[model samples]
Target: MLKTAAAAATGSALSSLGLRAASASTPRRGGTLRIGLGHGNSTDSYDPATFIGGFMQAFSFARYNCLTEIAADGSLAPELAESWEPSSDAKQWVFNLRKSVEFHNGKTMDAQDVIASINHHRGPESTSAMKPVVDQIAEIRSDGPNRVILTLEHGNADFAYTLSDYHMVIAPAHEETIDWQSGVGTGGYVVDSFDPGIRAALSRHENYWKENAAYFDNVEMLTIADANARISALLSGQLDVIDRIPFATASRVKSLANVKLVEVTGSQHYSFAMNTQFAPFDDNDVRLALKYAIDREKLVQNVLSGHGRVANDHPIGPAYRYEATQLEQRVYDPDRARSLLKKAGHDSLTVELSAADAAFSGAVDAATLFREAAASAGITINVKREPNDGYWSDVWMKKPFSAVFWRGRPTEDWMFSTVYIGKSPWNDTFWENESFARVVNEARTELDEGRRRSLYAEAQALVRDEGGAIIPMFANYLSATNLNVEHPERLAASDDLDGMRLAERWWFKS
Candidate 1:
């Protein structure tokens, strides 16, 4: 019920980015849409919390429905939950579930299902990456069959937006537990065959509640981690749509008569995370030296092909409401890096940087560029080209230094709580600052806009100067699709492929 006007303005923003304006036309259905993705892993799982790459994020939204959804225009909208109302303090939220919604397995979705599904990510035993978000819920209870109420431990102004996370898909409830392994949910499509890290096939759910949506008869998703392979599939007519278009090949793809390039500015960012818990990286001076050593400008021009803006060493971007734009932009300075290394009591520093294109297109090249730049500052960086197949499991977070990408959250608090918090399961850097913790926690409950922005500014400063994350650039969500596969004008900038809901929101033109 608290929809923002930002949705109405998203069309103009996308139009400026060269996305063809959508005309008013009837959508024709009944075609198999083949999608090529640049992300997936062999270690992926049925559990939503374990989802690491864009492939699983898109697949989850295609086959399962969250209580709430971030709409194509970047506004929060209802999905399984017909509507929601928040308490005056923004602590308690009550959601009214839609009636007669059936799961893929013919189970009727109700309040109990919502409760059980949410509980799957809560509790001390839960190892879900979203555990930090759900841990704020003090209690969850059903008012009736369709109404579910959640009371938070404290007032959180952005509590409702948290429910739209891809990991919050509701499943069929059975005796206080939900079955997630079966892939049964009240979504637009039902999974037919799933091969982790490779491909997935699904058919449209005939009983889907949302009418006039999900026009595709079937959807086949292919995991092509290599950037070249993904573009080849698109040009060869082997795929109808593709996500994560490589910036280097973007101009060439745009020139193809059969292709339509889609780009939207969002919170997506690329970073090099150094494990602060490990040696060498543990020293703040060493971390600052690394941060100053990399040339963000070169990465944006060379690696991103001038498609993104340089990022300060924090996750908050221009898209977020409370981005600390006033903070001094950190530029590459070899002398500063050397001074920081000396302050850390190191004459020279050497470290291996693990990278792969699976992290993002041109990630390995970015690592090589970073190595060359760091050499000027008495830092020796060894670029390790890791295999793309199991990079999420074997390299990311597991390795001391690695390339990573994030399809950032809609809200600042959600992003920080997920990856920057001390106890966050997906805190790849494993770094925490006391000042950051205090400001972020306080800002979560601060309802005043001016006061909240000030608190968040302090929080961003803390993360920029003290955290182990080296955020180099914020990239736009660039995708490519054949002209035959039609979509809405205002695409969601939240995640790639229309906020990872392309399978549900898009349709064939013929």
Candidate 2:
């Protein structure tokens, strides 16, 4: 049956699960919340269409608000939209807006703003990463100044969760377009200054609608791309918290008197994405050869410091509802890799693998470890260490094979649609299977839970055997914060720093 929009998470329920470590003191307001992030590019922009990496995701949540939110306990919560109801078919949805919500510039928000903001990601000329998501909408119209309606091409039980994506931030309407360049929105903080990929400063919104939130008076976000520098900034008292803590040094940081380690296991995973359109990778045998060549257990132990688990050559992980736990775990087999490489018309293969630590905490080291393991299978991997400054823009999808990481989506359909679909902009591997694509679309609208599970399991099998992505390990979100900082009992596992809403969701103890 189709899932209802009912929220299953509550304060008492989260406390019972012990999701968050409780603090002795209550949350107090009025202090600067400083943060250092490991992911940021010099090419980062204010356009929501281009927001990628950890730094930009966190920045979006601070200065912009989406229509819906995935709460700390993994439940849907209303943001700008107060309430919503579907038209029984789950295709047409009507969202009632919150009354008198003001933008950062003091303009009252209405249905027109929501409509224009959503439509910006649509249309044929768009290059937004979320175009595939919004393209599912058949039509979007306003019922009145306070209500907006969206009619999807197919019935989707997880449509509300899609809008909670960081790319769907609402902005004031300007004719047919939104003023995304100004960084203006109806969020808890107002953008004071922004230098692309360098630093950003924001002040608390004076007339913020959520009176109980946004405890910080100011937020200073730094793009500390180096992992060591990011940790140093937090430990030296130059920053309050940091994301992407190096797992190799986590224990040492935890031993510090003033620092605390925060780790949450989620759907985040690391992959070696090979462009299927590129040479050698186009063969299915070649892809299978690479998949069997890596030792996932070593990666989990050495690279991750045993903070994660081995992953099949698919994106779905343990955090998702329909995770294929029954699927056989792929193990390292040099003889099988050699047989597959020979079947692909190659006695020995040589490939260049681009990698940088910006992709994850120990990505460069992970690639080196993979190179050592693949050598036994007659695979010579040239690990090219790319620069962190513009790695995502230059090396990620542009290179034939490169290191990558995905903060996996909340739902099965959402994950497959965003990255696995044929026409998706973020389909990093550029691998497409007509049958796999068809199964995913069918699973989206299937109302029967048993039937949907069967379809998703099939989809996982197809990707595991034929996909161009070599997913090896699912890493936990490891971060550190000062003891003076206080947050809710549970942090959002969807992404680091409480789904990148740390500036608003966290506070100072004093």
Model 1, span 1-510: residue lDDT tens:
223432333333333432345673567779999999887777878887677678898899988999888876566788899888888777898899998999999988899999999999999999988899999999999999999999999988788788888899998987768898898988899999999888999999999988878889999999887778888888899999998888998888889898988888888899999999998999999999999999999999999898899999999886677789999999999999999999999999999999998888899999999999999999999999999777887899999999999988888899999999999999999997777888999999887778988999999988899999999999988899888888877677777888888898898886
Candidate 2 residue pairs in clash (backbone atoms < 3 Å): 20-489
lDDT per residue for candidate 2 within 175-294, as digits (tens), equals 779988888988889989988778999999989999878889999999887878888888789999998888899888889899989988888999999999988999999999999999
lDDT of each: 0.87, 0.87
What's the lDDT for candidate 2? 0.87
Per-candidate TM-scores read: 0.96, 0.96
- Clash number for model 1? 0
Model 2 root-mean-square deviation: 2.1
For candidate 1, what is the lDDT? 0.87
At residue 227, what lDDT does model 2 achieve? 79
